[model samples]
Target: MNVIPYNYSPEAIRLGILHIGVGNFHRAHQQFYINRLLEDSDQQHWGVCGVCLLPSDKNVVENLRSQNLEYTLTVCGRHGGDEVYQIGSLRELIWGVEQPEMVIQKIAEDTIKIITLTITEGGYNINKETNEFDFEDEKIKHDLHYKDQPITVFGFLAAGLRKRRAGNCSGITILSCDNLQHNGDTAKKAFISFIQAQDKDLAEWAEAHVTFPNSMVDRITPATTAENIAKLNELSGANDKAPVHCEDFCQWVIEDHFIGGRPALERVGVAFTADVTTYENMKLSLLNASHTLLSYPAFLKGYRKVDEAMRDDDICRYIRDFMDIDISPYVPPPAGIDLEKYKQTLLERFANRSISDQVSRLCADGISKFPVYIVPNLAKMIKDRKDLTRLAFLIAAYRHYLKYQLDEQGQAYDILEPAKSVEDEQLIESDSAADFLNLSAFKSLNLKTAETFVPVYLNFVNAIKDKGISETLKLLTA
Candidate 1:
């Protein structure tokens, strides 16, 4: 297949956007949009300068740099087709760990007007219970003490914004594409808190100039496996590294609150609105929460791929009921959105055979995900006195998955929860469901003292323990 590459010359494009955590999602979603915008118009200056903060990102950074920061993006469709595009929007790649000063300088540069982020939900270092930046985090502490040589994202932001202020560069918008609720506001709070602690003057400057616009970004971008790479190479006949693939469906709803001018993203499928809360809530609750609800149970049952799990009748019904019965009630319909269609579309997206989203990817960072995606809906269901059987079973599955490292097939896998603490370990290991319910993580919701919910949840936990996942799920649904 002769793939048409980016039409614009690399020399003419200017780095207008600086993105942190340049992983698979950023490439497939945000960069995909920018690539379209560039192809359609003369807005060549809106090119992205990608930044990788962690040391582990060296491989990707090197790969992109060696390839002149150009890579292929294969968008897979549900039925079986795919559209391949050469993404040239990524004009530059910077490894922050290798050259922290360069990262700061790029941020301070006047041409850079917007900074976007897809740092995972836990990267903010917020204490879920308190909903505040955790200054006590060891990385935060190090960043606080050694501001010149920073490590965490917060440190980089604080230092970078300080440089921007000193240089008298125009204000920039920090748009967060993470899946958290009110992600833009969360980013503001986390960044402002860090800056305020480091330098009151810089924080005040940021308050006056910096803008964090909340955005709801949706796209199912699976981790690029070795098999995917080999297949992509064979199809394209190109020895490209760091290529990315995602589902063809993509949506980006952003608040139009940029300090400086923004790319005419609206020209190319981006929705710029005054308020994104409703959209954010709907997506997070229905799609994200449903993912969490299905992940642990599917993984524990030895299902590795989301589509495979969706094919299972029992698992499919459980997720459908969980979304319609448990989550849909809490999510208000965003403007111009049909809730019924959206729910059905979510199911279709989950069942997209071409994407092959991994259960392990969904199960990763359960500690952070549970608080953001599951807790709020769980609390609402308890308060409303609705059916808690499915919700309870999901929690039970999470606990079981956490406690036991082995899946149903007796295969050992490491649970990738970095936020698990000593207390969390105790709660996961505890035999009593009531003990897990009383955890400080869920203390804010006070589900522990619920008159009916507690007992129902406990019973579900016991049933799962006594009668295995399959039978318990059948009994719950029946």
Candidate 2:
């Protein structure tokens, strides 16, 4: 009945921060930074109380509970790798259904100074039409009226904020560590919209008291696999709840805008900057964009692992050309970053075969992923009348990719559309690919001017049908 792991301490209940979506990325990147802070200050004040947003998250919740919420991080690098078993940063793990009230109570607690979210990009529930809170969503409506039944991340955050505000918990910070552009601003906008729709007085109170810090987080902790578990047991001699294995590379750039207390994470390679927009855009456009490039077409070609995709000369070259030709020009490097060096490092990280990040996982939610990661670079290229040949092919590849086609290997696949709607589906299937480009989400791209996109897309579909992914990649490069 000893659920606790060897050498793992009992869960430390601290009133510092609430982290939603305690996935591998959060544990490896964010919690690792917190662990560094703990090392220096000996302060358990910043310890995290982890929360899962969905009921399906019981797998992670039960795993954590079984291990007494203990885990290890295997930091893999080119030269060598090491394990940090049970680093002891996280304090408590609470599932949404089991303890929704408990989550709100913690957020309401005066000692809980900050909240961090890594709830993935899709978790935000952003409306494509307005790029704001999807107020019309049935769940949002339910949460607005009934405080007891929480469904959306924004709903839980709003409820918690409402409670926090009622308790005069001002000076609290909300940090968003998702792969979103100006993520903190988006979080703030979501909260503000919710409050205004429900109660203007509360909106003003949040605006006056709350601070949302924009942040850029980079570390590839792919979904844990059985192989990963076996490796962790072999290497670390510890069985983790959700053991995180990542490339040695990790970076967190945050805007210095916390209202409550924040850790001095800068001591551990986290950059606190005046403007994090450039850093965010650089990562999203370069790394995330390159990821999509490999994820879609490569996955279609029967590549499951990230390194497998990267190993394909054709796929790796396409990804490289995407960064070199399209993304880099638009990426204005933030202070203290070298763009060339960063790009080289990203490629190396992508080529790391040990992690085995799934292309299907990356390919999921492309409807949301591309607009932020790839489309922006293409838009900039279109405006300047630049060589969108590669960019066009990327879009074309995506169009062909969405049809849920299988490879010669008989592997099943499906693309995650922004919304499961006929109109949304038409974004990829339309005869006029340009018209589809006018989808509410991508209208900002001003695709009407890009005369070459439709024809290029049409040709791309033809190439895939006639020539296949490998051959089409060659043609695009040529």
Candidate 3:
């Protein structure tokens, strides 16, 4: 394997971007672009400062700091070739758990112009139904009281901005690289709302200074398992403890609304556009929604890996139908993209055996995912009175995956839904399928009152429980 070493020296680079939630996706996506930029001697000032906040990030924090903030990123090509690169752009690692003040201080520095985030959908702490910041969150309330010493993402950001305001520092753009529609606008809403609740003056300042550029990010990055790390190390001929891997396919389309100076990301494949909504809609509706459509049923059918699930004839056919028939008619093709080719590419990306993306990862956050990905098109389909069997089947499978962790083969699997609220938990536990309609994930639509959709959903729910996932999938797809 040929490992592409970054030509720039990490020590000589300056920290210009502070990225929160330094996970596999971030390592492969934004960091990958910045790694390329660092090769240009002029762009060395744009080195990344990775921030790890959650307790689960402790291992990554320790591993990265020990490795001098350098790691190998194996870009696994879908066509049986792989390219490895030594990523050295993350010059610094700060865990807010220990160095809370330091995290804030770094953000306050005018040198850090862009604060990129991969905090996941739930990480924003938005009330999905209302499309509002969750003010009642315990962390938000606590952070509001102790503003100086912050813990939550919002707390740290607000506190950092406040201190930055005091110093009359230059404006900074909070770029959200998450998979949410209108991510920058969403970030602005959540962060600004949180700031307004705490300090009106800072909120006013942020309104004028801080810019949130919406972006659409794409890449099939899986959770790096122990086996992945070991294999990557062997293939790269180096003992890299914090190795990350992803498919060769990568894209980022950003809204050109940076108040402060922005990186020359356009020089790389990163698309800087006036509006990212078209790209955002195309991705969320087709790629993300299709993932949700396939995940639960695949998981219930005893499939752990996404590539393996894609191999199943019925599963692949169902996903293609969902994308082409169910949602494609509603989604407008983005300016330069060929919708048919894009759909085919998405199918190919999902079936890439080299990456081996996990079904469990796709099944992780149904609570936050459904409202954004499936709800809009679902509502449209309901109004138009289209065939509701596919989406209805997905909801039934989702409920089963949440309520009972057992698969069709009688093997049990762990469910990861970090976004489930108290109400969601209660509804999931209810014996009646009707109660699931009240879930926050389905709050956008009155699933119970959708006369055409409800009965079909109920029938599928009954069918899934009685006949198991595989049989129900066959009948539904047939």
* Among all candidates shown, the one with the greatest TM-score: 3
| Candidate with the greatest lDDT versus the true structure | 3
lDDT of 3 by residue, 1-478 (tens): 7688999777789989999999999999999999998888888889999998988899999998888989999998889989999998899999999899999999999999999999998788888778889888888999989999788999999999999999999999999999999999889999999999999999999999999999999998999999999999999998888999999999999999988898898888899889898899999999999999989999999999999999999999899899988999898988878999999999999999999999989998888889889998999999999999899999999999999989999998887777887888999999999899989889879898889988998999999999999999998778
- lDDT assessment of candidate 1: 0.87
lDDT for each residue of candidate 1 in 338-399, tens digit (9 for 90 to 100): 99999999999999988899999999988888888888888877778888888778877877
Residue pairs that clash (backbone atoms under 3 angstroms), model 1: none
Residue pair clashes in candidate 2: none
Q: In candidate 2, which residue ranges exceed 4 Å CA deviation?
A: 1-13, 408-410, 416-418, 426-441, 446-449
All candidates: CA RMSD in angstroms? Answer: 1.3, 3.0, 1.0
- Candidate 2 residues 272-330, lDDT tens each? 88988888988898889888777877877788888877778888778777788777778
